[model samples]
Target: MTASGLPMPGGTGGERELLEQWLDLHRATLAAKCEGLSDEQLRRTSAPPSGLTLLGLVRHLADVERHWFRRMWRDEDSAPLYCTETDRALGFVVTEADTGAEALAVWRREVDRARKAAAERALDEVAVHPRRTDWQTSLRWMYLHMIGEYARHNGHADLLRERIDGATGF
Candidate 1:
């Protein structure tokens, strides 16, 4: 288990298995960071000038998962779950009615879709880039990119959680 009481990724496994394990661990870490916080607390910004919050991160990550896995990788005709074309940063701006539970539900659904998409293809199989249509990348690259993204954001989550209530851990 991690310091946050979430299960850690296994030490030994195949490359794909290990990658998925690490990704799951990071996902759990993010969830653990938001544990025990009220809806209002989850929406609290990390600092005065920044809009970063646990709920915002959850919403953003759900969009990320949907973009990469369903839209880009699976070639599904999906739209953004939270943001609009005019306001691309809407995920980071929580309203009075936006609750942590709703955000988490969306995140979990996207994660399930991502796993299904990944399972349908080999890691070495190439997927078209969402923005750069001419460019293609392997599933392995996508997994690694997501892991790095989560790791970086999880660090931010750690600090944000600490600032919220003096709680800190992996």
Candidate 2:
């Protein structure tokens, strides 16, 4: 277990097992769309997928980071700053006014919240869900769930970006 007490990304020996490898692949996929592109390139989206661009991916991840780690775990009373405040229906929609720099900033802010929430709770600590009256989960479970969620959506991002530029992979 690393600082989080959930095994390190590749384990202690630096050998990545099935799950870690899977998660890393998706993480790279998510990060790849933002590469080799300026603010303009990252913000372009074509058809389908609701024209969701990479900057929007960053924005959504920022929302995800806040939803799972911060508000759900730390402060349920507080509203999600990035998601609900922005377009509720189209969280992934990329606008012409959006910029890569702004999206990155939003993502970093949410990530900071995630880290703070993680630091406050232990692996086995249970968080009560304010919205979902029936749900409660350990911090460890939330961590695993979050990474999995990101990995899945990152796959979506990979396909979307590939269709955009024919420049494959994450």
Candidate closest to the true structure, highest lDDT: 1
For each candidate, the alpha-carbon lDDT, in order, equals 0.90, 0.67
Off by over 4 Å in 1: 85-87
Q: For candidate 2, lDDT tens digit of each residue in 1-170?
A: 33423333553443224444444445445665666677777877756546677777778777777777886778656566546754654567677787878777777776666777777776778987767869888777776777788777776677667766787642
In order of appearance, the predictions have TM-scores of 0.94, 0.75
Q: After superposition, how far is residue 134 of candidate 2 from its true place, in Å?
A: 2.9
Range of the 10 consecutive residues with the lowest summed lDDT in candidate 1: 84-93
Residue 48's lDDT within candidate 2 is 57
Runs in model 2 with CA error above 4 Å? 1-8, 12-29, 85-88
lDDT tens readout by residue for model 1, 1-170:
76657878889989999999999999999999988899999999988789889999999899889988998778998889988756768877888799999999999999999999999989999988766889998999999999998999999999999999998886
